[model samples]
Target: MTDSQSNLIDRYQQYRTRRFLANESQTSSWLPGWRTQKRRRILVGALLAIFVAMLAVGVTCHFGVEWAPLLWLPVCLVFMPVWVALRVASGRQDDAPEAVLDEFEIDQRNGARSIGFAVMQSLGLIAAFYLIFGAVITNGDNGDMVYAGGIFTLMAVLIGGCTPAMILAWTRPDPDVDDLS
Candidate 1:
């Protein structure tokens, strides 16, 4: 073939190849990574909020200010997972659109860390409580039933709040994929 004819054929082939690639990519069952991350964060946040709020309200009604010591349970249970999820979703990845993906990941990670830390702190408080009150609860001479009831109440509140938080922590990602920048 003549030089000009060969060049025209090559150009046509290149155009067809580009078009095919574009179409294939569009049809593929691949997720837009950023969008997927955002959706995940939303789901995690919603679950965390609902569960934490319920725990907090329940504990509040159960023990009033006596349960105040365990206030951190609600904070930790809700905050940590949400923070981690946000951090993972807010990374500076290729698929993340500018302006939209701002400090979202950072906030999410912070939330997760906050909640995780809170949960840990709450556990510490519970342990301390059990240690301090073990004597009173075990006393055979306890004629004051009210004091005993209060101690048992605290224990119950701690267990109620901590169990769900522990579950949430377990389900949450360790490093939070959203924060991968």
Candidate 2:
């Protein structure tokens, strides 16, 4: 890459780091009650279920089920905000820059990232196989299978991207209560 391109990338990273740090303070207030381990785990479960539902709805819609498209609006709106809340509730540990995290936090984030990467790789392989074989099996006559494969690929990306935050939210302990003077 050229120097200008590298400089642009570095600038973007710095901007993102600043944004994440600014958002961290606001995150604690966004969902104060939901920061507990139990609630966070629940959020993680709901997110996973929603992802699966979205994938099913997407594939079903491609198969000519007219009603499936209607379900997308509510599910998608709910999915996006809840996913954001879950990330915030986890203190954005998975996305925080190393400089902003302690050694323990860094270790946890790296471990979760590793797991997320593995999941993405596995799901990515499945998506690739599905797309290639789908076209070959249909002799390119059926476009719906292609659409279905696209939906599957999108769902895989969403699931893979969210895995690390989900892991952090699910495993992190509740914060200790402070004593009042």
Candidate 3:
């Protein structure tokens, strides 16, 4: 409330941010915004290609696949976006903590949390089913099982990582004035 108290708090916050950023591994090779943009475009294109291939292989075969290309593409496409977004992001997340956060940020955070929880719950159920039925379904061969598990793992990571950005992008606040240019 008082000037000196606020000043001390601000100093501590600055130190905290600096400390976190310094220790962050991503900072070591963090790309500029333009570079990140290029990477995002490329990644998205790769993902689209993967989706088409997966579709060609049939949706049912998307998971539990033994083909290395099928297995690796989804894994890379899913994980890379998460890593890139976290490391090279420029959003409210990178902004200083505010005494009063924006409603949009708060909503996005909540949405992300909900999405993450749902995905975890779904994954847990699937894991439980596979564990309980492992003998009956795959006796000695779990090649497909492992393949499916890998795909699901990637999906889980992708959903958990991108939920915040997806929500924020989906429900962004309007500009000061809505105008068509």
Task: Give the top-scoring candidate (TM-score).
Answer: 2
Query: How many angstroms is residue 134 displaced in model 3 relative to the true structure, after the best TM-score fit?
Result: 4.4
Candidate 3 residue lDDT tens string, 1-181: 9999999999988787676655444443454442344444444455446544433343344344445435456656565664455434323342324333477666656766677668767765665565447637778466555555545554555555554544443344432222111
Residue 109 deviation, candidate 1, in Å?
A: 13
lDDT of each: 0.47, 0.83, 0.50
- lDDT per residue, candidate 1, 1-181, as tens digits? 9999999988876776566556434433233352343465564456556555645544454344555536555655665565444333332122222223348643544455456556656755764564456546656343233343454444444444433333333444443445332
Give the better candidate number (2 or 3) by lDDT: 2
lDDT of residue 164 for candidate 3 = 53
Q: List the residue pairs that clash in candidate 2.
A: none
Candidate 1: stretches off by over 4 Å:
1-35, 64-118, 121-181
Residue 99 in model 2: lDDT: 71
lDDT string for model 2 (51-98, tens) is: 888888877866867677687778888899889889877888988987
The TM-score obtained by model 1 is 0.25
Pick the winner on lDDT between candidates 1 and 2.
2
Per-residue error at 12 for model 2, in Å?
Answer: 5.9
Model 1 lowest lDDT segment of ten: 90-99
RMSD of 2: 3.1
Worst lDDT 10-window in candidate 2: 172-181
